[model samples]
Target: MILTKQHLQNNFAKARETNSPYVFVGIKAEGVSEVIVIPKKSFDAKEQFYMNAYSEDLTHVMNNNVMITGLSYGDADQIPNII
Candidate 1:
């Protein structure tokens, strides 16, 4: 799926309203974009730790640098970056 401005707006609003992190994973296959939004207080430390480790492993395996960006509620204009 392609990430749209509206998608960003909604997710960022959700993040701000719920005071939680808006997380999405972009897969590099057929230009597919996968978005997964976990609710507030649902992503605990253990999951976070495993996610971080998995991300690191993917980075090493793919030999690509991973970039994590923090977006404010008003920064929904970052459509290109997300796509």
Candidate 2:
């Protein structure tokens, strides 16, 4: 998902409000595409489950939820510093 500047700002604000330690950052060919503030460790543990979910499935699963999925699992190269 391509996130607009406002979307990022909102996510950051949410992260601050919730006092989250980690945020899911998605990177595409162009640059960073999305940011999701994961609110549950259980959800983070199911990374593969979220990774395999289709976009439409993600839309349904993420309805009224803080966790957003469907980011490419293999996009690690995009952030060499983090790796």
How well is each residue in 1-83 modelled by candidate 1, as lDDT tens digits? 43333443455456656665444433343334433344345445423443444343233133244322222222334334544
lDDT of each: 0.39, 0.39
Local error of candidate 1 at residue 38 (angstroms): 1.4
Candidate 1 differs from the real structure by a C-alpha RMSD in angstroms, to one decimal, of: 9.1
Cα lDDT tens digits for candidate 2, 1-83: 44333443454455456655544544332233454334344334444454444243233233423333323122234233322
> Which residue segments of model 2 deviate by more than 4 Å?
30-83
Alpha carbon lDDT at 52, candidate 2: 45
What's the TM-score of every candidate structure? Answer: 0.32, 0.34
